[model samples]
Structure formats: structure tokens, C-alpha cells
Target: MKKNFKLLMLAVFVAAASCSFTTKSFEDPDKDKLLIDLITYVLEKGHYDAKQFDDSFSEAVYKDFINNVDPIKRYFLASDIAEFEQYKTSIDDQLLAKELDFFNLVYSRLDQRIKEAQTYYPEILDKPFDFSVSEEINVDYENLPYASNKKELKDRWRKQLKYTTLSTYYDNIEDNLFKIENEEDYTPKTKAQLEADARETTLNSFNDNYSFVNDLERNDYFAVFLNSVVTQFDPHTNYFAPPDRDRFDLQMSGRLEGIGARLQKQSDYIKVVEVISGGPAWRGEHIEVGDVILKVRQEDETDPTSIVGMRVDDAVKLIKGPKGTQVTLTIKRVDGTIEEETITRDVVEIGETYAKSAIIEKEDRKFGLINLPAFYFTMQDYEERNAAADVKKEILELKQQGMEGLVLDLRNNGGGSLRTAVDIAGLFIKEGPVVQVASNGKRKEVLSDRDSEIVWDGPLVILVNDASASASEILAAAMQDYKRAVIIGSKQTYGKGTVQNLLDLNQWLRNNDMGDMGALKLTTQKYYRVNGGSTQLEGVKSDVVMPGRYAYLDIGEKEYDNPLPYDKITPANYSPYDGYIDYESTIKRSNERMAKSAELKLIEENAKWIKQRQDENVVSLNLEAYTQAIKDREQYAKRFDVLEDYQSGLNFKSLPKELGLIEIDSTLGQNRQRWHKNLRSDIYVEEAVSVLEDLKLNNIRQGSLAKIKD
Candidate 1:
């Protein structure tokens, strides 16, 4: 998935960079302009599909940049937009000349508008909102025009704030009334007090947004602007600031020294979104999802620094540190109780991010189920522990435990390493092409599994969903092409065929001192199935299609504005797997069951309901109407809850190695237990297991199959 700076690409830049960029003495020492020149040069020479920097490209950058800065039409009035419209089609010309006129103007105007809006919020929150007023704030902001003037902007702020406060006000009233009715000696707060509390919450949220925005430096906004330009080529192509690049590396590595709780800034508080399994937070058993982190303190600190209204990035920097350190966090529990917990930071392996196996015991049959979250690998060392290596180990271990069939769960697996994906495919098939990679004006490179060792020559089923992308698609497509595995789950996987190479921009400069120049995740190649079909816009379709929530969602590569088009090249010279006796019949059997299942019917209904709800964007502002709507939704949604409670009657157990680890690591046990419980309720997994049972191997041994060597 990652490549070193291409030698030819480097050669193209080195001479010019060394001559023009080596000298620190310049007429204008503007790093932004320098970065623009460097990035544009790289894109021109190195990108897989370099787009023209013409009027159309300029117009896209203009619209995207404006949206990226002020998405909700809250800031930058009509006059400001009108003033900036002149450069809409001239941005390409400016970039070619390395001129920052348009960028500088917009940045200055946005800064001034942000300052002005900061003043507007506190003034607006000072007054109480009347919930009786039947007024609706249309949240369809993309279609809505910018405010005509200051008066209109102020009214927009007021209506938006009122809309936000309404929900909290209703909740406050409900909670108070419930307590008054249930508790014998409970005294309810006045309606005015409830209203005041709701206003305070809204005020805190507004302040938080401003505080986070205020923390942004010119470089941060510049990164956004750079992305707005680069992403014009494709959605995956992005400009990562230094901090952002570091974060991306951490996510890919799946190992971090921290409390290991994923935090997001919600209102004024840092809320725990997920407690990584086997990490300190999960082991501690105190911090949980929905718990708000109020303050963070290092081991040697005298006073805890209040993290309220702090940026999530800054808060994370405080919370995470080197291994064997201690950080105490003041947590506001979901139940509204306050508690302080001190946790020792360790080298936490995010267990969820790696390949984990569960043994499915069905009527004296032991089936292997390995859930791979990503095709992760060590960026520096491919030989180090990686997803493919881990999965092979899991497969071997499962075989040791009397495993007859396997189900590779790749649901919600936004892919990582490409090499690992090919390696994983090699596990299923003998020496053959896994995926074909093609750069613009270059011959297709057939990345094949050279190793003739078939790890698991058994009935295999792969479960994928809309979130399963890139490497996930490659592996699934390869297996599906070879008829080595029966792919199940969503109608199609996430169509993201492009391969990106994370290029360090600093590497392009010689003897330069502009600080960290950050990195660019550039799309260098497009990958295709071994069948020569690209999964660019059209993702790999499942063998036995199952209903999913994302079946109706616009989250695929095709929905993206400027995605690479789908095409086919000459198919790789590889023969299909002759291992399965009745692959088509097995698929047909699964489809027949899928059509009749009550659980699947309910799931489809739920997905439709979700799409219906997603379409209903217009919301009422009146308290009575809003509360009634909420109640109605809740009452209607009660039927869908049966889908969650539906049991597949399948027993899921851990392998022998994990069983021993579970005795010592209770957190691991708890994580597995929760996963198994969810799997039991999963109709998709149940179908996959059923398909695995139905699939009968032909046993036409590996070396015997006729292969067309290229």
C-alpha cells in the first residue's frame, strides 16, 4: 500500500529542488507558497492520473475550498463570497505562478469573520429561547445561500443555537419530570431553570467550537487549502500535516503507548468513543464509551490541566505518552457521576485492529472464524509481525483445533497494506496472480502469490460489507475470481481500487530549513482483480448478496466527485481453483435461504427505515412537535429491536491459545465475549457459516490444476 519515493520521480525533482529551494535567502519567505510549488510538482510527475490544472480544476478547488472552510454558510457573508468569486477560475493560473493572493485574501477574511462570529455567539446565548415559537431552521445548508448581511447572519446564529438547545431542554424537562414521578421526595426544577441549563449546554458547545478553531494556526488552514487542491484529482489523495501524518502512522501500526481510549471532542468534553481491547483503559474497566474526560494530569504534575473546550488532538497529546508512564483522567461517567482514575500507559496492541479468531462450534463441528480488521503491516519492516503473518498463524492454530471450514470476516475493514492482501490470497490459493496494479502509461504489474503453500485448503467463506475497501476488495475479488471462497454480506464492497504511496515532502528538498514539510498520500496506481476488472467505481459483488444498512448509502467510491473510472485490462494468466465441487450450487443454496430468512427481511426493513429517516432532513423547532416526533420514532423503532435480539443459536468459542490468554487477561475475555454475543445476533455471519458448511471441496490437489503461465 506504501512505496518508497520512485527513483524516476525523485530524479525529476532533485535538480530543480536543489537549485531553486536549497537557498534559505528569498525575496519572500513564505512556506505556504513553497509547499504549493512542491506539491504541484509531485502531482504532475508522480500521480497515477494527473488532472489538468485548467479552469474546470480551478473552479472545483474554489468551491471545495469555500466548503471546507465554512461548510454551513455560517461564516463569510454574501459580500465576502462575491469579493472572492473573481479568483474562482484563476486559481489554476495562480498555482502555476506560485501566487498566494487568493489564499491570503480568503484566510484573512475567514480569520476576521471567525473573530466576529465568536462575539455573536455569547451575545445570542445571553437570551433565553422560547420553545413555544413554531419556527424551523432548515439544516440543508449546502442548498441554502450565505447570509445577506450582518443582521441576517446574527438571526441565522440565533435560529441555529435555538435548534441545538431545544433537544437538551426537552431532555432536561423529561429527566426532571421522571425523577419527580419516581422518587418520593424529589423536587423538580422550574421550566425556566431547565431552559437556562439547556442554553448553558448550547453556550458551552459554541465556546468549544470557537476554542478549537482559535487553536488553529496558519499552517493548519493551509493544510486544508492544500487538500482542497490535491483532492481535486481524487478523494484518496490528501495532504497530511506533520501531526496528521503521525496519527495516520499510529493508526496503521495498531500499536501505541497510551491509555488506549479513542477520544472525540463532544461539546466542551472529550468523550471516549472506544476503549481499545487489551489496552490500559479496557483493563482499567472505569473509562468507557460515552464517558466524558473533564481533565488530564501527568504523573509528576501538581494540578490537572482542565481539557474542557480543548481540541481533540491537543487532548490526545496530553493523554498519550511513552510506555510505563502514568496519566490520571477525571471522567464524567455516562450516569452523570464524577470519578478520577489513574492509569499506567503501556505498549497497547489494539486487538480490534488485528486479526483475531473465534472457533464456531456447531453440532460437534469446529469452524474457524478469523475477523481481520485491516491488512496492516510495519511501515519500516515488512518482515515484522503483520496481518498476513498473524492470520496464517490463526489459520494454522484453528486447524490444530479440529477446524473443518473457515469464515474470514472483513466487515468494516477499511484496508491497509496491499502486500498483506496478496499474501493473504496466497494462503487460499497456490502460486497465482492476486491483483493487477497499473500506473498511467505503464504496463500492468501482476502482483502474484509466489509461495506455493496453501495454508487452508478447506471450505472458505469471506464476509464483507460496504466498509470493506481497497485491500479487502482485492483479497475478496481474487478469491471470488478463483472460486476459492464464497463471498457473502453486502451487495458489494466499498469500491476503492487506487493504491497510494505516502510521500514525505521533506525528502524532495535538499539542505532546506522550512521545518517539517509534512507528507502527501498520493495515488500512484490503480489495482484490478485478477480477472482484469477494476473495482474503482464498481466494487466486487458478493456471491450470496445479503441486505446491509449501507446497501442504500452513498458511501462508495462511485459517489465521490472525481473518482477514477472503472475499466478492464487483459486478465492475468491464472486458472480458477478446482478445489470446490459445487461452488455455484452452494451459492444458489445460500441465496435461496437468504431470500426466505425472517431475520434478513427485518434487516432489509431496518435498512429502508434508516434510508427513510436519512431523507427526512427537515426538523421541527417547536418543543411539543419535536417531542412528539421523537416519541413516534421511538415507538416505530421498537419493532426493529427484534432483529438485534434474534439469536442464530450458534456457539462461538476461542481457540486453545486464546483460551489460556483469557484466563490471565480478563479484558481480552470480555472483548471476545462481547464479540461472540454480537456474532450470535449477526445474520450475515450465520449465513457465512452456513455457506461454509454447504461448500464441499473437490480435493483436486494444488499442483494438478492447469495454470497458464505468463
Candidate 2:
């Protein structure tokens, strides 16, 4: 009886995985089965919490994989989903057997759907939309069901396109009205002509989008399938395709071994998209964005090789190499002038990848504001270019300029290196245990600062928001735990404590048979705060909760799918710093002040309204109704204009040493000026400054009431 049941299940799976809904046959399966087997072995061995590949896991993958492919319900009807559900439980069995039948069937069906769906958009756009109709479209895709039939699917596409066109239509009208309001002589385009333009723009965008989608190879589909499978284990653990790996490294580290300029394949020549901040190209100051690379030459060669029509991957091979190497490129500038630009390859530090400081002066007190965008550090060279060392340098410079208090701005700092976090924490207090890491089977390793001497023991205030993550959470949590720094921002920091190690797939292979299987960024361990709690889901609780936009939104590490469960271990041995004794009373007084401030109350209300508006997806297609909606929103938006307009009354300036770089790099100078301008108008910075004043260590007797008046 059991054997018959097993055979019956296998039969159902075979039938479900075979139906393609297309006449065109998929490419013959080659290394896909092998790839799946290899990935399974790695995930089983490497992932911190490998789940049993049972019926439950398979069902989760079946649902998530489909959503990842067709999120908007534009593809795959209810009939298709019904057919595919037959193998939903047996997908785990197939995966164990290293089968591609399930993936192949879905991939083929999606391709067929895409081919058919691409036709509907152009057809819909060819006709003019009647926006005067009293109808609305529901864009709540999560709640939406797949269309029952072909005609219904076409109608869905029509409504979606019409809504997109309406945005362009309204923007055009607003531009013309603005011109009229400013008394500029202008003739507005007729409604018919305006409709045509909007349709054309929508059509062009659809075509471009479909073109890119169609260009994706089978490997791309495999990547999606692989991630769908792995991310089921944990959000942080997954595979990286070659291009994705490059982008991840660049974005996270902001430094690559390549020529420090973003490149795009533009027809024939590889165009420089944009120069990286503080990169080799930026330092060379010879090549700029919009330059066309025609020829490339290596260090040993006298003659340059033309990469005129080479693939971007192949061209990049000729360009990127080891540090201290030289690569020369003949390029056409935007003005059509041709020149040879030689650049010495070096580790290009992305401007935001490190710590930057500004001396903010208010009421005869100079407070240091360290805007650490990300806690970046290169493992290859631990001592060089880490966030900790750079922040220490910034602090020393600010102190030279008579900085009294410090505001460590961790807002939007999606964190990096863990070692740097410990080191940075050391700089603020007399060092002890900073963080604890626990591997799969190993004992918890308590990371501590051996350094006894403090760098900046002055009154410290850490400014964090929901976007502040990982290493940022560590530093904030440490300081908050030690009662060393006053934490102030949105109620908490972004909770992400898991540590990931990027393992090269080639390292796992005994012999090189399947050429680069890409890399696996597997979550190997979870780190805990020194005070025993893990920031896995529960982020660092702020001392003083302030009003901001992200407060009401589900935007944190906890919001991610399949996150690791938060747990606690025995607390690491650490001591509280007696540097700032008035922190507790200062926080109490601030909360009292915040309770009385109408501005902060108004800000919280505005945050709730924004979240409510974001949750509303259904929109009217009628032009008059749409315009009225926009006007009503604008009327409400006018009330919150005072939120941004609040002046900090803080004077910010770059240190004398950095001002020279500002002179040499005009981009750096312009960015500095812009940042200073924003700081001058920032309400949060003003509030932070007020907090800093209250935190002035042993000198709290001079302060009676907060300077932020009623």
C-alpha cells in the first residue's frame, strides 16, 4: 500500500512537471542537475540553520518561486497554478534526486507568457485611453488573483498601462501650468496630442523593458531558481551570479580591482557611466563619465588593443587587474575630443564607504559630527582603509579644531566589517568586550578591545535610524549597554547580527569540471551584543525616540523573509564607562521636552499619514478624480513643510586638512558644500546638538533647562 502511494505521488509529479503550455521546446538540460546537487551539498553543510528538505519546505519554495517570477499576476492563469500545484509537495523529492523538471516547466511557461504579454502592451498603447470613465484599478498585487481567462488577462494589462500613462499625462499638464504661472509665453499641447505623447512614452518604456527581459539567458532563470531555494533557509544566505557578485562587492565595499569607473556596453564602445567617488579614475581626473573607450593597453605592451566591439565581460577582463597595475584607454570625450588617459590601478575607496567628519559649531561650542555611511574594511589589508581607523583620524582632527562633543551619525549606514565596529567602539570608551560571535558548533567567541586608553571620552550621542544595520547596531548597542553614549533616533537601529562569509564555489570543487559555479554568500554565524541579547530581530533600542519617516514603516532586518530567530547567550564580561554620568537624567528631560513639543507630535502624525497613503494602492483612472486626489494630498503635505524647514542654527565646516582635497577634487568640494547646507537646515541635528549640550560630562550643573524653546 505504501509503495503504491509513493508511485502515485511520483506519477503526479511527472505529469505536473511535464506540461509546458508552449509549443517551443526548452534547451536540453546540461549542467543544471549537477549545479543543483552541488548547491544542495553546500547549503546542507554551510548554512547556519539547514532545514529538512521536507513537504513543508517544498510548499514554501513552490509559493515563493512563483511570486519571484510573476509578482504582478501578469503571467500564469489560475489554470496554470492549479496544474503546477500537483507537484508542490513532491518538489522536495525531485530536488533530492537532482531533477530540473519542475524548474524547466515553470521557466518555459513564464517565457511563453512573457512572449504573449509583450504583444498586449503595444496593442493597448496604440489606442487612446478614456480616463474620463468612472473606474479604479486595484494595484494590491498580493491580494490579487490570477485572471481566469485570456480576455481577462488582456483587460488587466490594459488597466495597468492606462494607470501608468495617467502619471505621464498629469506630469505634462503640471509642467505647462507651471510655465503659465511663471508668465512664460507658452502654448499647451492639446489633450489629444498630450494623450498621444503619454502613450508613446509608455509604449517605448514597455518595449525597452521587454527587450531587456528577453535578453536574459537560461542561466539567469537558473539564478532566480537557485536563490528561491536557498533564501528559504535564510534571507542572508544565497548564491551570487558573476555579475551579481561584482555588484555586491562594489556596492558593499565600494572598492573593486577594476578601473574605478562604472562601465556600460553602449552599442559599439564601452561607455563610462560614472566615476566612483574617491576612485582611481576620480584621482587620475583624466577620464570622465560619457567618455567612450576605443582601445585598451596593458603595462608590458607598447601598442594598445581596440575593444571597439568586444563584450563588456571580455572588455572588463582587459581592464581590471591586480593593484598597482597600469591600464591605458583611448577615449572620445563628450565634446568629441580624443585622448589617451592612463590610470594607475589602486584600491578605490568609495566616498560613502568610509567615515567623514564635520565640525559643527553652535553657541560657541564645536561638536564633531562623524557621518559614517557604512562600516567598510578590506580583509586583505586590515590596518588600511577600515572605518575605525578613519573615524579615529577624523576625531583627532575635529579635536584639533576644539570639538567639545560628538554626534556619530549612523543613519542610513547599512553596516560592513565587524572588526571595525569593535575598534570604533574602543575609540569612544575604555575598552572591554565589544561583541560575541557563535559559529555552528563552536563556542561563542567574545570579541573585545585590548586597548585600554580612550580616544574621545567626551559626551557622545549616536544618531541612528531604521536603516542603520549590522555593525552600526553593534556599536550603538555596545554604547547603549555600557551607558557610554546617548542613543537618539527612530525607536531602534536595524537589527542584523548574522555574519556571512562569501565562499568561492571553485573552492568546493575537487577538480575543475564545471567552470565557475559562481559564489555562495552563506550565513555562517550569528553575533550577539556584549550585554547578552542578539540584534537578530530586536535592534538597538534608542535612548531618546524622535520623530522621522521610517518610524511607522516595516523597514528593518526583521521585515525580511525567513530571518534567523533572535536568541540570547550568557553576557560577555564588560564594564560601564563612568565618562558621562548625566545620560539617564538627560534622556528623562528630553522625553519631557519631546512630550511638550508640538512639532515632534506633528511629525509623528505626518509619519502615520505617509504610511497610510503608502498602504493605499487602488487609484482612480478618471483625470478629474486623479487631479483632485493630487491636490488633496498636496494640501495635507503643506502642513509638514515646516518639518524640513526647521533650522538647526548649527555652523558646519570641513577641517583644514580636508579642505585641500576639496580644492583638488571639485566633486568633493561641491558635495561638502551641499552637506553643510543641509545640516544648517536639519531639525534632527539641532535636537542632537541640544542633547549634546545636556550630556556635557561633569559640567551638567551649568544647564538648567534645554535650549530648544517652547
Candidate 3:
């Protein structure tokens, strides 16, 4: 339940929720109203822990919907809020009746307010900001009250614009000073000219943002309102619009038929932020990051269409096509040279998404490290490109290389297939219950490792962090409970113990007249560890709690809004494995070493300082105060520069299997080398290795054979 969220959230693989609802909207007249009825029924019937569609649900939706539309309170005023309050509690009534009067009224007012608000930015940015005034800006918008009138709204916009301009002004000043110092004959611009340039930058940024906002269609806004309604039930539950659902699929698979470049809309220009490593763009070597794509021409067309001011998704639609298709791009390079590059579109597979392995040699002892990015599996084929099979293959290859110890790095692994996690867990252990899953009205189902074979019977260590969630937590919790692997890294993993699955809304309708009604991702179940403890708010506690950047941050499932509470269940009937020597004492020894370690101490201190900096939200508008703030931050940053310098002399190398891949693309080899260098510098990795060495050096086998119990 709690462990399989990511896997379940991957909706591309899941079939239509059920053969279930009302097929056609007869007298509703409006499609939006019909959609509300359809979604409401689905939510009420399908959701595992469905909240009642009453006044309370209505109020929740109202708050979420209003906030989402005008999050910064830049458009709607206090009067608008007062006006909307009439229908706040009545939304449930509206939802029940399939009425759109409240939505229509609010939408119209918001649309008018948006048009009016556009004038404010241009007018406010027309003049230079007086940074000499001893004023402070509080960017914590949630705590602040909305403006009561147009005058107050204008003043609010003015202060925000001033803050944005002030930051840009300071940046320009620094750049100017740097140029004056470095360039022998460089002429520095006057303060007034720099100030004007800063204002222009601010103007461009706001205009670009407003253009994006203005370009949003009614359907897009409808999606926002729909999401607000759905997500109010739970943070995980959401309604993915058609385009969003498609986008989600693209993201999940990480393979798309395109020219293979990520585009960003920057001030009316579509910029190439990243050229996928193995994509057509990287193969051509013609396109690079920071290159602005000006126009796009398809093979069938004679003229290239100017894509300036085009929405990113729209631009992407034009750029992406089936494999073997040729698309010509007119790109403005960072150096200002415009070039026409024609790239043949191909299936761009994101290599980093898959499981990768590296072998580290220290003091003549070889240690294999398998980094599982996600508990991934091919949607079309169960056996193809799955993390479980990939891990098994990697482990077999590593074993052939005379590997002494293994480190399964699960840090930042948000998780994928629940079955894959169980399968992967089975690789190390002989056979036992891996996890216990429970849903509404279902018996506690035990996901067990029935195979009584140990793939890797050597020293094992699992690395995790605050970002390691869902299936990651399952694997960590299982290992920790059985005392099979030494869990190391952050205080605990991300406590997302609940599961979600997609239910296609179209499936609900029988005599369907309405078009494809996307899908609803609802929390269908919750899972518990073998030890009965729920890895919900309280995540899998590491045997060796290492300090990290996220150590002091308000992060993980506990920090998330409206997360399911943590609890415990009946501990699965299984005996703890005592296969290794002094497992308890080994953890004790690791903790003892970590207590006095300077590297871990520095990490904790650095994390605390970062949290402090994050909490300090108020910004000084005065030039001297702003400059001093930067200087202070820079000085503080310098103190932690030594953190990177500390390195363990571990030699890391690519496995024999990836050698061919490295040969084909030297970038692959370079990446491996880079990762190896980082691993050598990684304090957490160093500590894990240290713990593994301790376990390896002083182990007394409790059992003669690594076999499963009956």
C-alpha cells in the first residue's frame, strides 16, 4: 500500500479502471457540467478512501481552485474572494446538481481581472526602482493578506516588480564590475543605463510569463479546476487531462520519437535547454544548450514557421514526429550565428533512466555498485528492460568479475513497479515474505520471495536518502527488517507508503457520447513492511544515519500536504536472517565511527546553515544591504568548499558489458569516469564502503548454507 505509489502512479500500463457509469450527458447542455458529474461519480465509487462529496469537500475544492488560478494573488482582489464565498460551500450543491453558475461567474471575473492586471506590470516597470529606500520585501505570499482594492493591488504589484528589478539590478552591477576588472579596455555602463537594462529584463520576464498565462485555453483552465477538485481528496489523487496524460506517458517511458532536445520558452524565444545525450541532436552535434530555436520546417513544407511566442507544448508538437522523419530547425546559437540543421527523428531513449553499474577497487578488494534509478519495467513487455532483470544480469556480471561486496544505491530512486521491487529483493535473499499489501475490503496479501536461491551471498549495503520513496522504501524496509543489508545514508527514506492506480474515466460510461474522459489516479491501497511498521510518515530508518543536504530540510512524505498518517500492522510471520557475523555489533561499530567522523559533522552543520538560509525569506531592497547579503552568502559558501575536496581513493571502472557501449559513445565512458570521480568524492559512499568493510572483516556465519526456512 504505502510502498507501491510510484509503480501504481505509472498509469500507462494500467488498463481502464473498471467496466463501470452514466454513458451520455442528456440534458446538461454543457460539457464541463457533464464532466463534473462523470468525475464526481468515479471519485465516489472508485477511490479507495473516498471523501464524501458534501459541503466540506466543496469548501476544500473552492480554496484549492481559487488559489491555483491566482496563486500569487496578482489578479483577484479581496472583493473577488468575498464574491466567490457565496458559492464556496455551495460547490458541493453545484457538483450535485451539475450546475456551472458558480464556476462561470468566478471564471468571467478572473478573466476580466487578468486583462486588467496585465496593464499594471508595464506601468510599474516603466520607471526605475529606487533601491536606496530602506524597505524590505516579504515573499512569503501564503501568510500575507490579499489586496482590498485596485489601489492596494497596484501597490502590491509595484512592490513585487521592484523586488524583481532590484535583484536583476544587483546582478547587472556585479557583471559590469567583473567586466571592468577583467577586460583591459572595457567601458563600464553608467548606473542609470544598467538600471534601465535591469528594468527591461524584468519587463521581458513578466511579459513572457503573462503571455504563457494568456495563451491558456478555457479547457486548460478547466483542467486546473478539475485537478483542484480531485487533489483535495488526497495529494496523490489527480485528474490528468488528455495532453497531461500523454505527457505523463512520455515522461514515464523516457522514450519519445523526436529530434531529442528539451525546449524552454524564454522571453518569446524557444530555447534548447538540453540535447538528449543519445538523441538525433547529440548525434548531429550541431545543436547545443543555450541555442534558441527560431523557426521549424517540416520535410513536407517549403517554408519554415517562426515559433517565437509559441507555447512550449505547441512548439514541441510541431518539432516531434515519428521516427525516420526529417525536421529542419533554424537555431540561433549562443555565439549569435543562425544555422539550418536538419535532424532525422529517431526513438530517443533516455539512458540515465535505466539501471547502471560500476565496480570500485580499494586496497585490492573489488566492490560492485548497482544504481537503480527506478523500479522500471517495459509496459509492452514484462521481460524487456525491467529493473529486476537488469539488476540480476548486472549482479551476475559483477559476480563473474570476482566482486567481494555489493552496494545497491537507491538514493533519489522514487520507485516504479512494485512487482519489480519484490523481484529485485528476491535476488539477494533466499526466500521469505518481501512485503504485505492491503486495500479496502481485501485480506493482507503477502508478496513473498518464493525462490530459495541466494544470488549475492556476500557483504551487502543499501544506500538511501530522503528522495528514495515508494518501492525504494519497500526494499529498504524489507532489508532492514530481515537484517540482510546494512542500510545507510539519510535518517530515513521518503515515507510514501500508499499506492495509486489510474482509472480511465471513459471506461466508466456505457453508451458513451462524450469524448475520451482522461483518467483518475486514486490511492487504491496501502502497504506495510514485513515487520508490521508502516513506512508512511516515518520512513525506513537507516542503520547508519548519514547527514546530507536534505538532512535539515522539511522534506519527504511527512512534509507533504495531506499525506496519510503513519501506523503499524500485524508483523508478517517470518524469522529474521542471521546469516552474517555480528550484524548487530557491526551496525554499532559503524555508528561509533560516524559519531566522531569530521566529514559527517561538517555535512550536518552545512545542512543546518542551508535550512537557516532557506528560512530567511525577507529581502533587503537597499543596494548596500543586498550587496552585503551576497557577500555574506559568498563568504559562508567558501567555508564549505572544502567538503568537495575530501575524497576516498577508490578506483571506479565501467563493467565489461558497458565497455562496448563506451566504445561506441565515448560520452558514456566519460560519464562513467565522471560518476566514478564523484563517487570517490562522495562522503556518503565512503561511509557505506567503510561499513561494508567492517561487516566483511568481522563476520561469523550463523548458518552453514544460505537457504530459506520452511
- Report per-prediction Cα RMSD to one decimal: 7.9, 7.8, 6.1
Model 2 over residues 1-710: C-alpha lDDT tens digits?
A: 00111111112122222221211124435556767877889889988888899999999888878877776678788888988898799888988998877888888888888788878988889999998999898877767899999899999888888888998998878876787788656776788888899889878666644544554556677777888888888888877866566656766665778668878765556889989867788767878889999999999999999988665555777888778999998999999999998888887666756678899988877899999998887655777567888899999999899988899999999888888899999997666999999998367899998886577768888999989999899999999999888888888778898988887777766876655667788988999988899998899888888868757877887777889999999998887876566778999987788788778888899989988887877789899999999999999999988877877678999999988888878888988999999989876777788888998475452232122111
Give the range of the ten consecutive residues with the poorest summed lDDT in model 2: 1-10
- Candidate 2: list runs displaced more than 4 Å: 1-30, 180-185, 264-271, 277-288, 291-319, 323-346, 698-710
RMSD of 1: 7.9
Check candidate 1 and list the clashing pairs.
Answer: none
Q: What does the lDDT come to for candidate 2?
A: 0.80
Model 2 / residue 378 / CA error / Å: 1.3
Per-candidate clashes, comma-separated: 0, 0, 7
In candidate 2, residue 216 scores what lDDT?
A: 54
lDDT of each: 0.84, 0.80, 0.80
User: Could you tell me the lDDT of residue 151 within candidate 1?
Assistant: 97
List model 3 lDDT by residue over 316-434, tens digit each.
Answer: 87899999999999989999999999999998887888888889898988888999888877665667568888899999999899888899999999977788889999987778999
The TM-score of predicted model 2 comes to 0.89
